[model samples]
Target: MAFSNPFQTYQKQAVSTSRPEELTYMLYQGLVKYIRIAKNSLENKNFEESNTFILRSQDILSELMITLKTGYPVTDSLLSMYDYMKARLIQANINKDQQILEEVETYAVELSETWYNAMKEMKIKN
Candidate 1:
């Protein structure tokens, strides 16, 4: 039998059991990680590697946009931000621009921190 990595198994179980809020926070964390890695790849002149990571980041942003509930006022604003980030990611991938990737990373960091704080507050309340 082929062996599966234990960490991958743990991650799959964690995601399957995570609440919606936790999932959102996890997505933000993932987006930030991809952008940072892409930035490093760009700096090293690894254009293909950078493009791959940028695409991953863009995919996560798209998933977040689709999963977001539409009724709330904040949803519109968040959608706009996601659109802007995706556009920047495309531009970064096309031009291999570290600056554009950094801009996207800044947004990702802000979003992740905000979501993490909200998650903590919800846990405290419950």
Candidate 2:
């Protein structure tokens, strides 16, 4: 996104293009990566690695909200989501449950979809 206006970069996408979908996919990939790391770490009883991935996932979520320019409603929801995700990460670390990591991944995917849809609505086509 090397543009003077970041929003403009998103707007330039072709109507038939897959960039928007790709973005969603990319977010999912990130979620999968982090969650997988989390699962492996939790399975090995590596609390630190699990914690790290959780924090990374949280950071990605924060960046997603900022990128989407989400309004109050979305912002409020994101706040709750972020809190829940962080809590889950901590719980996964403590309980060493791979399932908990998968649950968090589900939330991440949902959030990505929501963010991409919201941004699509706001985009001003070129």
Whole-model lDDT per candidate: 0.93, 0.71
Task: Kindly report the root-mean-square deviation of model 2 from the true structure over all alpha carbons.
Answer: 8.2
TM-score of 1: 0.96
For each candidate, what TM-score against the reference?
0.96, 0.56
Model 1, C-alpha of 114: deviation from truth (Å): 0.3
What lDDT tens digits, residue by residue, belong to model 2 across residues 32-75? Answer: 68888877877788888788887787676665555554567866
Candidate whose lDDT is highest: 1
TM-score result, candidate 2: 0.56
lDDT of 2 at 108: 74
- For model 1, residues 1-126, the per-residue Cα lDDT tens digits are 999999999999999999889889889999999999999999999998998999999999999999988888899899999999999899889888889998889999999999999888988999
Find the number of clashing residue pairs for candidate 1.
0
| Clashing pairs for predicted structure model 2, backbone only | none
Error of 2 at 69 (Å): 8.3
Off by over 4 Å in 2: 1-29, 41-48, 58-71, 120-126
Candidate 1 displacement at residue 88 in angstroms:
0.6
Where is model 1 more than 4 Å wrong at Cα?
A: none
Query: What value of lDDT does candidate 1 attain over all alpha carbons?
Result: 0.93
Best candidate, TM-score: 1
